[model samples]
Target chain A: MPKSNLDLINDCDSFPYDTFPSQQSAFTGYYTFLLPNDARPHGLLTSATVQSMPWTSDFRIDHSTKTVHLLPASHNPADLASSCTSALSNLITKAIQTNTFPILHGKHSEPYPILGAPKGPISIERFARSLFGLTARGAHLTVYTRTVHGLSIWVPRRSPTLFTYPHCLDTTVAGGVTTGEDPFTCIVREAAEEASLPEELVRTHARSCGVLSYMGLRDEARGGGGGEQGLVTPDLIYVFDLEVGEEVRLEPGDDEVEAFYLWDVETVRRGLAEGGFKTNSAVVMVDFLMRHGVVRPETEGDYVEIAMRMHRRLPFPVSARQVL
Target chain B: MPKSNLDLINDCDSFPYDTFPSQQSAFTGYYTFLLPNDARPHGLLTSATVQSMPWTSDFRIDHSTKTVHLLPASHNPADLASSCTSALSNLITKAIQTNTFPILHGKHSEPYPILGAPKGPISIERFARSLFGLTARGAHLTVYTRTVHGLSIWVPRRSPTLFTYPHCLDTTVAGGVTTGEDPFTCIVREAAEEASLPEELVRTHARSCGVLSYMGLRDEARGGGGGEQGLVTPDLIYVFDLEVGEEVRLEPGDDEVEAFYLWDVETVRRGLAEGGFKTNSAVVMVDFLMRHGVVRPETEGDYVEIAMRMHRRLPFPVSARQVL
Candidate 1:
């Protein structure tokens, strides 16, 4: 049976239609989350529904100003950092208790990678990621090759005992954009750590393929924290396409990945249709198929919708006055 | 003397800060240009500013609804197509009168590649491109080679007698994204036409390296129309990085390009600093250097700003309701 576009996206992690208010709300106020690479808002944030979450206690919403204050204006960098850290620690402890320890619990020793914040070591960034309170930018590499049979994708099976969708399929190389590191640096580091590939080879072969931004209500049992309330996970993964020769092989360089396999495009499509791959990874693969012209509007009835869904609209203000 | 990032972008074409109204204005309304392959608004358009332009006679703005209707709802696609054709023909005629005929006046037989438009031929796409009224999406290929001494970029010199930016330095191969064509297919077509590279070789060597989206106001003497009003040229060029062997030699295949040269990275940077290359091409080169780690953020004070500027925020609605 031929799989439809809806079938492919059926199990993919997606935000509920009513998760975010269609219009700005007076009660919740705007400035719910931080904008990546920019300090502006294109539209007002109306996550009024999420204001009552336990992790959001540190943030104060002012109905009078219709704004979200991340600590008071009188708070210095030190005070702000302390508040963020304290809030994040409580959330992380609770999350870890239910989901087990994270596979890569990074040192909270770096300054949070805020767009316009002061630079210093702050571990709250890691906590922010677990809570999905903040949008964590990262680079994902989809390494593939063309053979006589046609195109095949290289996928990694995550370690079974680790946190976060353990035993699921992932892109060839993926990791978070840490506080001090850029997308390229992160991709290179992850390629070496997650997959035992030579640095020189990875550098030459990998190519940046824009960003895949998505907002989803992640499951608590799937290593995402915040209990059944479900954290709003806003992620921006800088997609990279790398074409390697047939001789190149990938071995699991770290414990994050359990094994590596090269699956043909047919197998990949079927996996995506059957919801076998991790939701995010499936989105990435869908993007790959669209770019390569494998999936066309004629073949996929919801082609435009699928293509447009790859990026979520982030509200960015035109002026710096909105920056808190 | 080395040039700073500001120096590099000083003369580059860009939108005026005031072109778009401040914050979803009801009087002017908001129509965001799209970030490619996504339904996100990367930037907004205030038709209030454009409503007074010479060629925008057909576009009617409804302040109450906050929408800029391309044509009256009563007008059919055929009627709208005729209006677009009439506007484009006049603009093209005026443009050609001054700068010799265009090297390649593409067939108006293709549908206007509006995201939500019907799939049929419409000549107005060319007019939209020349007027820079709506954003035009295209794919650009930056072919380079890795040598023992580091990297060298392939540059093409535009023909002195050409219509647009005559004799200016360009990427190894560059072209527009025709209505129905995807980036990969466009690149393949352009590679053969501009650089005379074999189709098979281009397919194997080229790698998709994200997109460089910028909004610029171009000059009247150049191919850009809209006269003194200076159309806001919103462009999203899908950047391709093709690594070729040191042995391959490129010859200009089409009359659009006068000559081809392979300059090392240092020479490319110096040319860019001195404004020897076209403004957009300069931006693209800077992006290439940044991704390859040839440019460091610590060394470059405007690193973050430069990276973010490559992709301007365009305003795109969630639904497919904005087709003209």
Candidate 2:
């Protein structure tokens, strides 16, 4: 049986992309093997899609041949170009630095309305897959708390009862925006569903919004039935800045959730560098928060580091594709 | 005969809302009333949306008491409640702000899906009585240019053919972001269509997008048959941000333009504030640019500010039903 969604996310945490063998590209055989088969070549606005994709290039001692053969179900096609090349490349580059990888697994090709109906939710299969691996149809909202001292943050945690993932800890408030839902609505809703926080609580410290993108070159088709098999796809990733204050309560919905907490700068830095209690997503998020001065190492006023060890393994290639 | 679309848009440059006293509204009053019969509560979500939204009491001026009604929309419904208290109260609030005294207009409802299909363009009549306004259906894009300098900006001069107040002349390029198009595609396409510039010339600076609500708000329910009332009548407006450098050659699309030029920050500040040009869009845009610090006071730029201004007028109280 396929792993649970939570389990897949845990997989990403367990085997991150940054830990791949990246001394050179030519020798990284398995890394290149998982190039997404854009059968139709369109991901964003087309058909045929595969989420939580995991590309692994195992390390072997065969110094003579230096053989890095493609793994199971892996294919390299001259025509099956990438809808989003940068996503893969990002994973590879990060992998060379570390040995683990991240992955996303979801089904595709939702039936849009032919007679003026809103496109419905993604397949249940896909949702389940995302829990196990890195899932598509998700959004990231960074809550930058402007406190008396400085800025603070609130990151959501993944629940254990999740249909897919199990042990892995992942993004704070990341989830799919169903066709009809707006991005803002999506984030607020997800934060509530997974963590059981009130909408009013989340909206209190709202500040500004921004977007982020993860993309690379385009390639031919490697997918067939999904959205990216036939058309052009741009690997896109956008993040919104959801600001909150230091005096907020995060009501963890169920046992699925362990707790809701606060984060500071140094703690974030330590987590990213030392790996005391986190994953790549946490590390990247820490880096981004640091860049914006949204999270500081210390704070005097209303601030608390809810989880000194809030990081969990996810099943994704948290690093880049090229370096691996 | 009532005004047609071309007359309202191309001729008057005002939005086509449900009018009162024959001026889009519920009652036919002395002033061109909005909100009464106005179907569009939010007006148009156009380029001007940013300037006139959220209806903060800060912008309102109450002369009766010669004071700011920090909460003019404040209610005293406790004394007057019977059967429909909830519905009545909500309506009163909406109505009070719907036409904020001076402008008498604000916010619009979601659009009625005028065009049946998403792939191609279709002529959509906002409303049967909606004939008092214009119906525009098209897409726009914001392309960017690159330079060693921080960033390039285009300020248009008020277009000669456009008898409207701000014809996007002080800006470099302007157009609509039609349905089914993302920001990247929209900007590039708009650059090509409005300025006759190459799509590549316009590059993207940031993905952070803001809403520009204009006065125009399309409502399709009154479009005679009332069968397809809930049309996707967007509060039509442009969503874009692009860059153009000193070296790029720009040719305004003749179909929608008369001439084109460039301006620097100082030039814009001096000209727009001093009434050197004939468009109001420039001033607000300059304010937007200035507030955002996208451009500074002194820089090697190109622009000519149009002497455009905002709708100084607003909504007032009416209705003998309550006042009676």
Candidate 3:
């Protein structure tokens, strides 16, 4: 039997991350996450506190609470990104020294600003790496086709040469929401790039579903890099479902995706149980199945638990960020 | 301004009620609730502890931890109901003494058994009152009509003579799931009784969307009677949406409902802000609006908080009960 969603999130507790209040000059509602002193450190931290980092004096770390805050609350995203570029590059280089890394693709863009809504472009690599110590946001699209038999999901397999979760099953279209881009725009671009789908078809058929959020330690074994094991990953995934008819054909539009597979719900469930899909994609699929009534409380013993886990309920003010 | 969902549930914390493990003799997985010493009395308790209650020799309450337990592990729902009849009647009579109460409606049937999947019948009143200290489950239906102007929800003005939330707005149809009954059947029955809708139309139009669960103190101000304030109410509300055509008309099928109002989204939002709807129905409407794109993150500052609040995330294992 496949492990329940509750089991997957058993260790993803949020209490360990102490919170830092917004600084006097920055946006008022947003909060930043700080690793507690007792937490195991990944390679990212220079010392036990955020203030000890020698790169730039743009952050504050409270020793009493062990909380970390970005300084000069009005600091521009571009200037912040510019300041962190060398430090971020060094960290990525250190990671590559321990593992084979793939060259980054797509335009480096700014995602919705975490604290304030600002239009600024940051490298996608840095955003994913949480170089600024903020949660990252992404858009994941689940493309499915319904026939007389039942529902079948369009699954993509990552290229073997990619650095992250390569050759594993993934959602039909998934991409990080860049620093300055809207979720809808990001998903539309990804749909065309990853699946060779027309913009019109994606815009016409796509529905904005709810979101999936999670905070957890990065899986170091997956080639994210060894000393990177305890790097905190806080993500807010905006989910969408696109329905395609039998007449529509999907081919890999980019080298990042190796191939596509249309698998029935049962088959998908089995594969998910056997760990055939990427972790985030599996979470999205499980949520999709639950929402469509393909899975029910009677059939699944942990249905309530699974449903609650998808919400994540991160304490950060994600909606207050004008960027989304 | 309409109160945000977070504001509405600000004081509705899920503590004060201590958990009681299932007795060794009865079911293995079922649990019950007991009020802690510091909490206010709900008037339902015969004594400060569950052990002191005379009716069921099956229950045990530990003073040190303030934990309660049902002793007979194998006690069936029917047997449990039978054992608590007199005690439950006492609570009901006490309630009646304080306020005018309406006669309970619907078939007094047993719902899905909690621990083991067995068929049995328990009175709707007892189940709603949770005489056995089990979570009560019910189904609520939202019937709406879509036209050129926009979508209009069929809101029922509850009868002034009714005991609970008198004259307040309610869903198109809502009813408690009785023992030995299924959610679908209960909703269908409620649709016909509360709205005079044809059974065929109801069975065909109603779609099982999802569920909303909450755990809080039952309102003592309502006709459920004073001192009823502290009684813990853990509920799993199965939600459904029924689509009706413009030509269809809705009338109160019974005196439980006084009138019907077809209100557009804006009007309903105003009414919610003005405190025109019952509490639970307000939650259901907020969820429906969010799901249907009527409420967007851009327009609603508390969108994330509202969405998270709808899940409730009660600690009790609602799924352990065989009943849906």
Interface RMSD of each: 7.7, 25.7, 9.9
Top TM-score: which candidate number? Answer: 3
lDDT of 3 at A14: 28
Model 1: CAPRI class: incorrect
Best-fitting candidate, scored by DockQ: 3
For candidate 1, report its TM-score: 0.68
Model 1, range A62-147, lDDT digits (tens) per residue?
A: 55554444442334654665555555565455445444334215333333454333323234445545343455566788999989
Ranking by TM-score: 3, 1, 2
The local lDDT score (0 to 100) that residue B205 gets in candidate 1 is: 67
CAPRI accuracy category, model 2: incorrect
What is the alpha-carbon lDDT for the whole of candidate 3?
Answer: 0.58
What is candidate 2's CA lDDT for residue B235?
30
Per-chain TM-score of candidate 2, chain B: 0.40
Q: What is the per-residue lDDT of model 1 for residues B99-184, given as tens digits with 9 covering 90 to 100?
A: 32232142332334544433232344454443334556667788888999989888988898876577888878877777657777
TM-score (all chains, Cα) for each model? 0.68, 0.29, 0.72
